[model samples]
Target: MTGKLDAAFGFHETALRLRSERQGVLASNIANADTPNYKARDFDFARALQQATGSADPAAAAATPAPALARTAPAHIATGAAGTLVAGNAPLLYRTGTQGGVDGNSVDMEVERNAFTDNAVRYEASVTLINTQIKNMLTAIQG
Candidate 1:
């Protein structure tokens, strides 16, 4: 029962964390939109989520060759190439701009904003699902 509960919530928990991390990455791009030579970086959310949930594609992971960081202590800061990856410490990829900036800044406000907003919605959904799962587990235990 304990194992099943853990397995059930694992994907949602990882998704929540990854989505939160992606939000920050997108926000950073938006924040640095004006900074010269600020190359925008982001990861494929679907790929990241798949990796975090231990559903990574071996071919993809092998091609990328991610460097992972393990947090053994509670006080250890999260690895921020996007918060120390879970299934693998996949590196962030640079975003290609539709309209290049004169100053070599890669961030496009519209794209960044859209991605940020979309990630927020997905994050909230993951949180809601997790909460529902917890509630169901509690009810089952109580019964």
Candidate 2:
């Protein structure tokens, strides 16, 4: 079934998705560094990927405890924990710059640059791993 395919491919797919999402979040933060009252947002890559791939059945939780068919809406929909989404993992607070800017933006250029670099490195590493896995799979199939 589709669930099985998701479970099998989830690792690579989830990592790629998280990497892309993180890039967007980081870029946004960097772009808004000078904007007043702009709070940075990011995703918890590890937690989100774990949650997405950990379950055997992607929709199992949602399907369970079925409600009445006639009900307009279910009282509660199965939801992942808070801060588990792509943008909930951003640092809640950043230290105000010693030489604070008049705009009240606290994003330090050096810090954001370092963080972005590190994320890029990690993303590359994940891509390498996935590529190696694919190559190995191909070799096995050919043999």
Candidate 3:
């Protein structure tokens, strides 16, 4: 039964989790826009999702070793390969600056805003999908 449920909701479950995590990263980028030397960080959602779903070719996966996000402190969460969470490590990639600032901050308000909004919409959509699936399951059980 648990396996069946996992199979039913696996994709959306992973997607929703990744979306929420990405939302946090985007928010952090926005919050640190004014901070000097702050590099905007993000991850490849499609690639992460692909990795999480175990659909990637083994050769490709082996070729790319998981890279860690730059951490300011020793206690920060360690990031690694996409879609595989090992002790809170999420794969984070630094965003390249479109326009360099005097203070060396890489965050662009326009880009962050757009990405934030898009991630939020996708998150909401994932929630809606999960809800619909649950409702359908309940209806079937009742019938």
Q: All candidates' lDDT scores? A: 0.80, 0.63, 0.83
Ranking by TM-score: 3, 1, 2
Q: In candidate 3, what are the lDDT values of residues 6-58, reduced to their tens digit?
A: 99998888888888888988999999999999999988888788887887677
Instruction: For candidate 2, write residues 8-111 as lDDT tens digits.
Output: 66777777777777777677779988899765565556655655566434474455322332333677564334322453222223344545556767667776
Q: Is candidate 1 or candidate 3 better by lDDT?
A: 3
The collision pairs in model 1 are none
Q: What's the C-alpha lDDT at position 76 in model 2?
A: 53
Instruction: Give the winner by TM-score: 1 or 3.
Output: 3
Give the per-residue lDDT of model 1 (tens digit) for 81-124.
54535333556788999989899998989899999998898888
TM-scores, all candidates, are: 0.78, 0.62, 0.83
Model 2 segments more than 4 A misplaced:
1-6, 55-84, 87-100
Candidate 3 runs further than 4 Å off: 67-90
Index of the highest-TM-score prediction: 3
